[model samples]
Target chain A: MSDSIAIELRDVVKRFGDVVAVDHVNLQIRDGEFFSLLGPSGCGKTSSLRMIAGFELPTSGSIIIHGREMGITPPHQRPVNTVFQSYALFPHMTVAQNVAFGLEMRKTPKNEIARRVQEALDLVRLSGLEERRPRQLSGGQQQRVALARALVNHPEVLLLDEPLGALDQKLRKEMQLELKSLQVRVGITFVFVTHDQEEALTMSDRIAVMNKGKILQVGTPTEIYERPNCRFVADFIGETNFIDGVVIGRDGNYTVLETPEGLRFRGLAARPLSDGTSVTYSIRPEKVRLLTPDGALPPDGLAGTVMSVNYIGSDTRITVRINDRRIIDVWEQNTRSTLDRNEYWQPGEAAVIVCPPDNALVLSE
Target chain B: MATLQQQQQGRDRIRLALLLTPGLLWLVLFFALPLVIIFVYSFMTNDALGRVVYQPTLDNYITVFTQSLYINAYWRSIWTSVLTTVICLLIGYPLAVFIARSPQQWRMPLLMLILIPFWTNFLVRIYAWQIILANNGIINGFLELIGVGRLPLLNNEGATLIGLIYGELPFMVLPLYAAIDRFDFTLMEAAADLGANKIQAFLRIMLPMTMPGIVAGSVLVFIPTLGQFVVSELLGGAKVDYLGNLIQRLFLRANPINWPLGSAMAVLMMIVLLVLIMLYFRATTEEER
Candidate 1:
């Protein structure tokens, strides 16, 4: 592993009896980076995170933290703290007491404990709540307290396991921004786990999408979203309208694909393809635009009707019936939408859907 | 509609009152009325043939405080009970923790082991202690065979204390185990991750978390130890005279004239227990807030 890595799991394996929770996974987290392990439930994301936190030991491999193999360093002795899913604040301690706990454990002087606890609490925007017990606080407040407790320890890494899962959607989004900014301000390595794809994209510096205890792909949010390496990666990240096709041959930087709807489209070569190879491609809904039947298209074209029009204030979502057999979603910005059924179009009326060739992501058939 | 609803509310209140009347009347007639009679007995004088005479005096209580023989016995009994309680807690705490921390698969079987001693009747257990702790009992016989002389164990204060602790240990273990096991284990781990060593985490986090169980267990152990007679009688024979033994003697063995004296003594012990438990509960609630 590189010396620049804060924590690294080398061929780690975890098994719970007959169930292999985490297969042999290898990952290296860079120093002071906000990394997220994104996956659906039962996908081994949390198991991998737990191994890094030392809550669990990898079954068949070593875990290195701070450039040292943590042979048997128990969770308490490790220079890392975790913000649990439920916050797991000490019920008996006041907010101040809870925050001061880590420092006090190291025999920190009483005054120093008080100072650091207050500083950590203020960092999480929870001040003057020192005397309140965990039970007295709201869920979001408790979550903040848990964060402060970990932050006050000044650990090299913070392990957050679905920290915002319990909050309502409004609070979850707000906390997403809060966590992202806090990570930047603190600049400590954070290993977060979540099944919420949007949250992973919004908060993570890099995301490792996991499935069945293995990393499908890991990359920057834009890279993973714009150029998914496989069909699962493309489908899991966001709304992508899949188009089945066959690859004929490659053009210097693109591939010409013949679709099932008797149309040929030119697209960026997602992977090397041979002549006569069957393939599939996907494009985001936002990439497809609704046009008049006479409007021009860049080789890739499908004639369809407006099945259902959802008039969102900022963007209109229309399900377009492509070739009278398939439906491709088209999202139009409210500012650019010029369709008026009474004047130009109506439901079940034929229209043309144009998708730029470069926007199509080649996927496995 | 509103009047009908109000009428039902009134009727429910009446029904609740009626439901409580039987138990409350029974307690007043049997429990409260006996205490009143005992209070009156404590003040009255007994005649030559040990018949009750309707004259009031504070003579028995005064004698209890003024006489060294009675005063020493009272303090000695209290000291032994305290010793028994301390020893029971020392041994029971670790055992309870062991059972509590065991995996779920083993929990029921281990708890059953803790409860199994109670299956053989309580008195039989006390008598079993006699066969082991007596002067020429199994323990002494073993000692003799192992080239040691017979040691004086039974009919001694230490013997009663041991029996008392052995008998009370399970009662202590169950409640403490329940409390410790019910603790949020993740909180302890959180404390550790924050920077606590194992011991500090337990002291600052685990200790305070399971305090309710400790309080309940201590009360349960202490209250019964305050007035245990069978273990004291079987192990100490006639020499061990705890409050329970005193109560028993007044009713079944002691001079009949001294019945009122023993009743007064029993009432005093009951008052002491009530006050101690009340103080304990107050302290716990204050700490909770």
Candidate 2:
């Protein structure tokens, strides 16, 4: 894939009356990259996607697609197509006719339209059902038709706004993988808008995590999960245990934090913080190591009592009460396939919770 | 177990009969009986003393089919109704779309405004149009005040057409509004995203999708206007004689009351309307399938 920017948004802001739907969102989507706009509902992610599709004109700032600034350029003139959230397939047209609509509008020759429509349908694995109307197809089939309809246009970029939101969980999961593969196969810039964090993580080459009309973070999946810059990013992406503390010292890249209860721990911070500054140390439950306190406690580890233990098939979740007040979770892989009670921690048992210094993340906010 | 199943079936039959009784009774009394009477009357003759004679005759039916005046009236009525329907569709489509796409707060008010004409007595509203289109009435008065000569606005085919379209505009607009209102606007956006310009999107996506409403509105206007009497009588001042006016004159105003001829014309009008409606339904249903 080329690294040249396929689409760029410079301080794009969209306001509906007094409510700002999208704040000053500046984005650089590289050519042939599967970029995802990830957030909860009403987080301006879909608004950003709509603006890129030219469905909406920015209230201020400018959007440049392939280096040409799109100012009041209607969606029909833009070199991008959208797979609407509703799957928005033309109900009156057959699947093939719907797929051929764009090329027909462009006055492409009939033979070429037929060839491209077939290829697009086959790409989405919907070759046999070309004659069916949208209502005749299943939800998944309709979604495939929508995908084919948009892809047949061969636009420079493709905008998908929660296209698989209506599908059942099993179908959604299947489509997510299929969509990612399709994007890779087509090699077109895909700006996907989805509220499902896992979907974004699974499909996107890079993700922009947005909140309240603003993008909070943009990075690769690993960077977003491991090095979340703020408390919101940490909580939104995945489950993590937060230990509130004040910075006591710095050890190389790690910030040493001391709890009000006088327990000390070390974690990495996005930026260096002054000593005595209040901070929250975050560490994923899976990163924490649980052991019997009496058996082999790490010298720097905190001691706690196991409040609860849940056996969740592949992993056992152990909630430990530290300093008699704070409850921290520790996830342990169920490596032992045998169903033995002794293999997992029991409630009210003494335990030591420890994590590698690099796995812990410190949030100043 | 056999007795229980039989009793359940009997109870369901009674319940179904109870639910259907009133509607069936109404249709039989009002619709079926009147149609049968009209059909029978079409084959009977009227006496010279303006009284119906209990004599079956083909002469009245022949006169209706053969008379130039009746033929011209039927043709004029059919063409005028067609014109009215087309005009309603052209004007009402955009208006209905505007109302349907309007903000939620404005939608009900706009719809209520369209329905305001229906609240008044139908004749009174047509009478109001008569006054408005009259030479010395509101519109022409305004025109004369604006330094333009008073054009003949009333008692003509043009005035009658305006009246028909004005009276039927709500029928055209309401159904179209209902269909457009229920439409998923996202499809339009999808069309635009698929490289369809505004006109293309409207023609292929919006227009075809809203066809049920168009057919419904057209049928409502066309059927009524074909047999319209009041608009032509009042606005056209009997200058524009349509099938409805001819039937009225034949039954009441002619030197000898021609009940059989009028009844035959009425039956013929009903048959024409039924055929048109059936054809429309067949075309739409086949397209849907």
Candidate 3:
């Protein structure tokens, strides 16, 4: 990705009657970047994509595409294309005609249109079935046609509204990789909107996590998953055990926190927090280690009883109850190939869970 | 003994036959029998006293094809029907799109307004149009009140067209509304996203997708307008003769009424409409390929 911006939204607010679908959203999508707007349904992710596509005009803010103000500029006038979630291929037209519709509308030379249409079809690996109507094609094939139809236009940015959402799980995964590679090959800015976190994390170069019409955080997938700045982003992206606590002082690089029961803990903080500030300490299950409690407890180690041990393939998950009111989950990978029943942690065992300060996060919601 | 499955199959067949008996009998008697009678009569001769002669001849068909009076009526009927169909489509398509795109709470009430005229008798509504369209009627009186002298607002082909369009608009609107309602409007957005303006998107996508509705509405308006005589009679003041008026005269009003000639005309009209409708369906569906 370059330093140049492909699209920018300046304090955009979109309201449908009384409901604010996108509230004061400010975003900058860089050129040649695979950026994703990740959120749950009705979190305004799709609405944000639509705004960039020029489908919905912002009620109170300006949108800039390539430094041009897109104020009341209709979708067609904007230099972007969209692949809708439903594919939305014309049922009447054959695959070739559907792909060539944009070129024809722009009055492109007929011979050039045919050539580009063929190239686009080949890009999506749909060259042999150009004459078939949309109804005759399978779901995956139709999706490819939708993609080709938009890409053939060669817009500055391609907006996709959960384009792979209609496919089965296996096909969705396959398309995610294919789409990511295609974006890299084409080197066009891609603004993808999806509610599936795994799909976003697997494909996006940078993800903007949104909720309730506001963007909570925007960062790389690794940053988003491992160092989520807020409680919502930490919880939404992946599974994490949150322990409510108050900040005590800092130790070296880690911030020390104390729970209500006076149990001390240490974790990294994205921002500096003053002492005595209430916060939530988040640690992923896989980041925690479980050990049999011996003589004295180690620093930041909580002695607890194993509440449940679930041996899912590849990993054994155990919930440890430190006190009567709090339980934290720990996941241990099964590195050993042995299937011995005694190798896994058993319920009612006394265990001490240790959370590394480097892998943990002190999130201020 | 027969197998249980075979016995059930036999019972199902008997039940199916019983269920189909009434509809089959009604169609055979009232629909197919009349068509057969008309076909037979078209080939027969009419005597001097207008009684049917058993001897078969091609005279009625020859007269229908050669006579200027009959040819003129056929052309006039076809022209008027085409005009009505096109106008209804131009007007009804937008109206149906408006209704279909309306808010959920307003749709039912708006559709009800379209259908409210159906509750009254057809003749009663035409008579109301006559009153509203007469030279000294509602429209002319309003014009006169506005200080513009009354214009010739009635007893013309234009008035007849107005009446025909008024009566047939709902037929066009209903089917178009159905097609537009079933249309996925997201395709319009898809088209626009790919660098198509609003007009281009509608022409290249919306219009073609809603074609089934257009074909249905055209047929409904065209066939009825082609056979209609009342609108021309009541509104056109019988200034011109149409195929329906000629057929009505031969069957019921003319001196020494010619039944064979009327049957031949009716048969020819049916043949023409069938060929036209077939060609229309073929032309419209060919675009899908």
Candidate 4:
């Protein structure tokens, strides 16, 4: 990705009657970046994508594409194309005609339109079925046609609204990788909107996590998953065990937090927090290690009893009860090929849960 | 003993036949029988007293093909029907789109407004149009009040067209509304995202997608308008003869009711409409390939 921005949303606020769908969202998408607006349904992710596509004009604030103010500039006049979630391929037109629609609209030369249409179909690997109508094609094929139709226009940015959402799980995964590679090959900025966090994580170069019409955080997938700045982002992106506590003081680079029960824990903080500030200490299950409690307890270790042990295929997940009111989950990878009953943690077993301060985060409540 | 499955299949067949008996009987009795009678009548001879003779002849068909009166009526009927269909489509397409695109709460009321006219009798509504279009009617009265003087609002082909359009508009709108309602409007956005302006998007996407509705509305309006004599009689002052007026005269009002000639004319009209409708569906659906 280049330093130049492909699209920018400046305090964009979109209201549908009384409901604010996108509230004061500000974002700068760099050129050639695979950026994703990730959120749950009705979190305004799709609404934000629609605003960038010029489908919905912002009720207030401004949108700029390539430094051009897109105020009241209709979708057609803008230099961007969209791949709709429905695929929206014209049922009456054949695959070739559907792909050529944009070029025809622009009044491109007939021969050139044909050539580009063929190239686009080939790009999506749909060259042999040009004469077939959209209905004649399978769901995956139709999705490719929708992609080709938009890409044939060679717009500055391609906006996709859950384009792979209609596909089955296996096909969805395949398309996610294919779409990511296609973006790299084409080198056009992509603004993808999806509710599926895994899909966003797998494809997006940077993700903007949104909720309740506001953007909670925008960062790289690693940053979003490992160092989520807020509690919602940390919870929404992946599963994490949250322990409510108050900050004590800093120990080297880690911030020390004390629970209501006076159990002390250390974690990294995205921003500096004053002493005595209430916060939630979050740590992923995979990041915590479980010991048999037969040796001397580490300084950050908590003695607990194993509540339940679920031996899923790759990992053995154990719920360790630290106190009467609190339980923390720990996942240990089954590195050994043996299936001996004694190898896995059993219920009622005494265990020590040790969480590394580097892998843990102190998120504001 | 027969297998249980075979016995069940036999019983199912008998039940299916019993269920289909009434509908089949109705079609054979009222529809197919009349069509057969008309075909036979068209090939029979009619005596001077207008009584059908047993002798088979093609004279009725020949007369229908050669006579200027019959030819003129056919042309006039076809022309008026085409005009009515076109007018209905021009008005109804937008109206249906408007209703279909309306807010969820408003759509039902708007659709109800289109259909509320059907609560009254068709003839009663046509008569109301006559009252409104007549020279001394509400329109002319308003014109005179505005000091524009009374214009010739009725007793003309224009008035007949107005009446026909008024009667057939709902037919057009209903089917178009159904098609537009079923249409995924996201396609319009897709088209626009592909650099098509509003007009281009509509022409390339919306119009073609909603074409099934257009074809249905046209047929619904055109077929009825072609056979209609009531509107022309009341609104056109019976100044010009249409196919329906001619057929009515031959069957019920002429000096010697010519049944064979009327049957031949009716059969010819049916053939023409069938061919026209087939061609229309073909032409509209050809682009789907």
Candidate 5:
């Protein structure tokens, strides 16, 4: 199943009355790939997940899973399982019963169902918890039980909708890695939907960045992060400062930008902008360097005044106000200098911020 | 000043205790005391005047045990209440689920429709059913207007059973509606995604998850049905005698001297309902295991 397509969505359009939730989306998820639909709330991510689950049928287009077209095929007949955000475990049944329910539905042999349930529970590290009800377990353990309940069926695809949203930060992080390894161990295609960018970055093999009712970009985490196709994707993925300017010169792969404040800036050339065309340069705050006193190494740097300084463990973040117009954020690695971070930079003190030219992203629109 | 504060604290405790006393006293006097009295009466023998003879005998209980009359009434009441509860559950559970799973704008109106029957008097509703079910009533007229067979919906065992079910339907629906409204529907979707068919999901997931509401609705509909006098009187119309009718006839109509028998019947009915309620609670509790 390595190269086989597990699920395919072609021109899927879903409407709720007059509102269009998913607008003619086309996607193909390969077998064993951990794919994520990352978006903010109400961006049709959950709607797309629901369509694949057969809980909601698309107004048009086809949902093909494992080479079978699911045309209004009820959820029970689908060869896919979902782990819900709330971990909707059965309250009346023990963990073992909950896990065995799917096998019972499929008419598996009683003894075999029992054995398989035990194996699934063991995989989820819930060996001794078979007899406990859902309420007896903590949030994380219940989450695992939900996973075990779904995985016991060994469906071709697994849908997870915000499965880690209810977890605390530490548990969510732990579950992130656990879920990633579990997907690898099971070797099944996973379609995870979440609005958390870091969770997607850490866990997904391919990420689809969705906004509104359309997919803005779909790529590997590195590709999406290092080179976002649009401004929204870049801003949503991580922090970056945008400076609007006009293209002044083009030198093969490098371009010179002139901000309205008359500060000449250098940035990379992606899609070349014509000379004098309005554009924006995105510069990562961490790439900015604060020049020290005494004729520092940088001879050509933007002049500014240190407006504020914040100390965070291993880094000092200083904001430099430029010509009373723009502000550039610079992160300085702490070296435990003689001057305290608070004493080192005060408001209205002259400062210089510098970064390599290639670190800036050029945008035309 | 310290003494004054202490005095205020003492008075506060007194006020709090006073606030709790009325409800406690009501429970003890109206509920707990009556149950204890029934407990004593179940063990004692009564004379013809309905006065306690002060003689310790299980003769009344023995009569209840040996007499086929009392035994049949006891069994019939239980069976009728069971049938009522089951029918209500079969009908109300789905209705509640449909309402709860419906779109947001429709939820409140459908819930109000379920609850509107309860806004007025249940007795009045039973009377209305009487008018609708009686021979040559509006129902029969309509049936004739449509040229259909006449229905025997009153003055029969089946008619009383139907009344029992109808009277208890709302009770069943309200509890079930609460359960369904609070139900996390994602579990059903999860079950479906886990490759369980709709029947399996319903039996193993939905039904068991809604057990508390089912049990609550069952008990609420059952105990009162076992002892209800109005439905049997107005709808059954003396064609058959249920436990409630038998007790009433014994004390008030058949023979004034048979108050002992009525007391005995009341005591026996109480025991039967108590046992039934216990059995239902046990059955529901086992589901948690």
Candidate 6:
């Protein structure tokens, strides 16, 4: 992807009567990048995408698509296409006809339209089913037709609104990879909107986490997952154990946090923190190492009792109760096939859960 | 247990037969029997004294085909019915779409308004139109007060058309509403997103999807208008003569009542209606398949 911006939203706001669906937001998506708007339902992600597609007029801001200001331009006038969540395939048209509809609307030469339609059908692996109506296809097939119909136009940008939400679990996984590869092949900017965090993390080059009509953070998958700037992003992206604390001191790049129980913890702060500032320290379950009580203890390790041990085939998820009130989960991967079943941690056993200071995140929101 | 299953199946068949018998018997007795009697009567001649004559002859059929008066009435009926159906479609389509796209609370009320005219007697409604379209009626008087001068407003083909369209509008709107209410509007947005303007999207998506409604509404309006007698009699006075009026005069008003000629004309009209209905079914079924 180039450094040139393909779409830029500047102070964009959209209100539907009494409800502000998209609050004032500013963003810039680079050319050919697979960007995602990740959030729960009704979080203004779809509204932002619709504004970019010109389906909606921004109440008080500007949307620039490839350097052109999209001010109240109708959807048909914009150089963008959308794959709707409902897979809005024209029922009266065949697969080829549906794909050719956009080109026909633009009044392209008949032969050229046919060629592009065939090419798009081949891209989605639906070449042989060109003569069939949308009703004759399965859910996955219909979605492919919707994709091809939009892609055949060779639009400047493509917007997908939870396009894989209706598919089965296995099919959704396959299509996530398929859609990512398709974006790469076409070399077009894809602004995908999805509520499924795993789907966003798996497919997007960059993700903008949003909630309540505002964008929380925008970064790569690992950056957003590992160095989340707020509690909502950390909690929404993955399972995290939060321990409330007050910053007592600063140790170079790390902050020393003291819990109410007089337990001290040290972690890297997402932003600069002053002494005595209230903060919440978060650590992913997989980042904490679980050890036996008799093992060599790290200086910063907290002694706790194992409350529950769940062996879920791939990993052994153990919840360790720290101090009197705080319970933290530790995940241990099943990397070996030892014959002894007793190798697993038993309930009520004393355990030491150590979270390396570097892996801990101090979010002050 | 096998015998019990068979007995249950037999009872189900008998139940189906009992449910269908009433409708089937009504059609065969009141509909099919009359049609057969009319067909037979069309070939028999009436005596000069208006007495019954069972002698079969082709003279009545020849007269029906060759007489200019009967032929002119048939053509006029066809032309007027076509005109009425077209106008009804033009007016009803937009109204049906408006009602279908209306808010949830207003849809039923709007549809109810379309059907309120049916609660009153059909002939009474026709008479109401007669009073409204009369030369010295309320509309003409209002026009004169507005300085537009009194115009010839009634007892003409135009007045007959207005009455026919008003009476048949509800039939057209109901079927169109039913079809349009179930339409998927999201497809229109998809069209617009793919680079189609408002008019193109409507033509390419909405119109094709609602074809069934158009066909149904047109057929409903066309069939009844073809045989409409009261609208012409009340609005056209004695100046207009439609197939229905002609048939009524033949069987009931003519001296020594020409039942044979009336039966022949009725059979010919039935043939025309049957052909039109069959064409409609064929066209719709082809599209569905």
lDDT of 6 at A279: 93
Which portions of model 5 show Cα errors greater than 4 Å? Answer: A1-4, A275-277, A292-300, A335-349, B1-21, B31-69, B103-109, B118-123, B149-152
- lDDT of model number 2: 0.90
Q: Say which prediction, candidate 3 or candidate 6, comes out ahead on TM-score.
A: 3
lDDT of 4 by residue, A1-365 (tens): 78999999999999988999999999999999999999989999998889888888999889999999999999998999999999999988888999999999999999999999999999999989999999999899999999999999999999999999999999999999999999999999999999999999999999999999999999999999999998999889988999999999999999999999999999999888999999999999999999888778997899999999999989999999999889998999999999699989999999999999999999876
Q: Over the stretch A170-235, how does candidate 2's per-residue lDDT look in tens digits? A: 999999999999999999999999989899899999999999999999999888888898898899
Which of 1 and 2 is the better model by lDDT?
Answer: 2
How would you encode candidate 4's per-residue C-alpha lDDT over B107-144 as one tens digit per residue? 99999999999999988987888889878999999999
B39 Cα displacement, candidate 2 (Å) = 2.0
Name the runs in model 4 displaced over 4 angstroms: B1-13
Model 1 complex DockQ against the native: 0.66
Cα deviation in Å at residue A355, candidate 4? 1.7
Ten-residue segment with the worst summed lDDT in candidate 1 chain B?
A: B250-259
Cα-based lDDT at residue A357, candidate 5: 77
Model 4 iRMSD vs. native: 0.8
What does TM-score give for chain A of every model? 0.94, 0.98, 0.98, 0.98, 0.92, 0.98
Each predicted complex: what DockQ?
A: 0.66, 0.82, 0.86, 0.85, 0.66, 0.74
Across residues B19-98, which tens digit of lDDT does each residue of candidate 6 receive? Answer: 99999999999999999999999999988866548999999989988989999999999999989988998999899989
Error of 2 at B216 (Å): 1.0
B213 Cα displacement, candidate 5 (Å): 1.5
List model 6 lDDT by residue over A1-365, tens digit each: 89999999999999999899889899999999999999999999999998888778899999999999989899999999999999999998898999999999999999999899999999999999999999999999999999999999999999999999999999999999999999999999999999999999999999999998999999999999999999999999989999999999988778999998898888999778888889999999999998888867786698999999999988899999987889998899989887576999999999998989899988896
Model 4 chain B: worst 10 consecutive residues (lDDT sum): B280-289
**What fraction of the reference interface contacts is present in each model, in order?**
0.83, 0.93, 0.93, 0.93, 0.93, 0.88
Report the C-alpha displacement of residue A257, candidate 2, in angstroms: 2.0
The true-versus-predicted C-alpha distance at residue A72 of model 3, in Å, is 2.1
Model 2 — TM-score against the truth? 0.96
CAPRI-style class, candidate 6: medium
Return whichever of 1 and 6 wins on DockQ.
6
- Please write out the lDDT profile of model 1 over residues A1-365, one tens digit for every residue: 12399988888899998888898888989999999999889999999887777778878888899889986788887878999998989888789988888787778998888889989999999998999999999999999999999999889999999999999999999999999999999889999999999999999989998989888888999988998887788888998987788987776677887877676766776668887787777889999877888755435677778888777768778888876567889887776556564543357777888888778776755
lDDT by residue (tens digit), candidate 3, A120-222 = 9999899999999999998999999999999998989999999998999999999999999999988989999998999999999999999999998999999
Ranking by TM-score, best first? 3, 2, 4, 6, 1, 5
